[model samples]
Target: MAAMQNITVRGVALCDKKRAGNVHVELYEKDVLDPHDLLNDTHTNLQGEFKLYGEQDELGTIEPFIRLTHNCKAKPGCMRVGDYVVPTDKLGGVYDMTYVPLDIVVSGEGEQCI
Candidate 1:
């Protein structure tokens, strides 16, 4: 039988010491052979704070992670995307990211001008 697994994530996003509001954040279940499954998504509030809860039903463990997309510190027509992995043990509970900085450019991937 498939069991439902869930997780909660909360945090504030910042850029150059200022609140980065409206930042896009999404949770996903990683898949090796297919597209990753989106579990939950939200935009940071005006205060740059966000809390998200996501649930998935599966027969085995689900590998969860987060993806953040923002325009902080980007060029006039570009955006930045970053991905973070959630500890498997944190499933069925909360994972606090605390304060995250969006100004730091993601290495290698650079910025996407779309």
Candidate 2:
């Protein structure tokens, strides 16, 4: 078995029209299924910030992305606001994605405020 290395991912979730807080963020290896593929998940802080940590044998094998869920209490379903792929090639031992903007428009009738 190959040795595992600690990898950290950090980013901020921002909404162009909203406060951008309380958004759910999930990190997953692209094309992998749930339970085993889910590396880390967390909600954005008051300032729309979050961090995730995981271990992998090689950084290249971990094709990670941030899935943002906003307006979770929608009557029909939760909105998958954005899916941002982290550029692993630009990553060192630690990856800092800086800020990921989630711009979702809540239109139509009975659209609840986030």
Candidate 3:
């Protein structure tokens, strides 16, 4: 059996350096053969700041990441999604991302029209 592992992440979501509120932030644990496990999720406050913490019991080290969904200057009826991975060594404590600018598309960023 494995012990429960935990993670804490906090940051501000911005678009062109301005606060981007209501952005959906999700924390997930990477899994090899199954769908990624959703640990926690929340929306940034009016200040564009968010804080999330989650825990899971796994046989191996937890590979965690944060996925952000936002409109951030996208055309109406479109949204952009980005994923920021956390270093495995950063688990079990707070990892402050500080600021995540949404204006710039990050690696693996995808756009969805809805």
Candidate 4:
């Protein structure tokens, strides 16, 4: 389904081939994305195992999905969907695609939005 300006993506963190952490969905534009930008809503080690819900201008599913990027944090993992790097024994887990209903808290913009 083409969500035009908004979409919901559900995912989970796979560590040691097992789901270790809850999945997250963040809206970031490549031209202006940094680790610090995302660290605001959730807390996690550089390993990236957390969940967050934020609104972004879809801009049509920005490249190198945030899902794969977070998954690759487990040593030798790097956005394998499009930016896959050589796999290493650092963490022997894999990613899983799941559909968890994340209700949209707001459809319109909000004030005090960081």
Q: Which one is best on lDDT?
A: 3
Q: What lDDT tens digits, residue by residue, belong to model 3 across residues 1-114?
A: 798999999999999999999999999999999999999999999999999999999998999999999999788999999999988788999999999999998998988897
Model 2 residue runs over 4 Å out of place are 1-6, 17-19, 32-36, 57-60, 72-77, 90-92, 104-114
Q: Candidate 1, which ten residues in sequence have the lowest lDDT sum?
A: 103-112
State the lDDT of candidate 2 residue by residue for 1-114, as single tens digits.
454545577877766734468888777666544343667789989988888876556434667666677764344654555566667774446678776656543332133333
lDDT (0 to 1) per candidate: 0.89, 0.64, 0.94, 0.32
What's each prediction's clash count? Answer: 0, 0, 0, 3
* Tens digit per residue, CA lDDT, model 4, 49-108: 443333344344432223232332332422222222112221123322342222212233
Q: What TM-score would you give candidate 3 relative to the actual structure?
A: 0.96
Clashing pairs in 3: none
| Candidate 3 regions with alpha-carbon error over 4 angstroms | none
Error of 2 at 71 (Å): 2.7
Per-residue lDDT value at 85 in model 2: 69
Task: Report how far off residue 97 is in candidate 4 (Å).
Answer: 3.3
**Tens digit per residue, CA lDDT, model 1, 43-85:** 9999999898999998789899888889987888888888878
Using all chains and alpha carbons, the TM-scores for the candidates as numbered come to 0.90, 0.66, 0.96, 0.32
Distance (Å) between predicted and true CA of 71, model 1? 0.6
Q: Model 4, residue 31: displacement in angstroms?
A: 2.3
Query: What's the best-to-worst order under lDDT?
Result: 3, 1, 2, 4
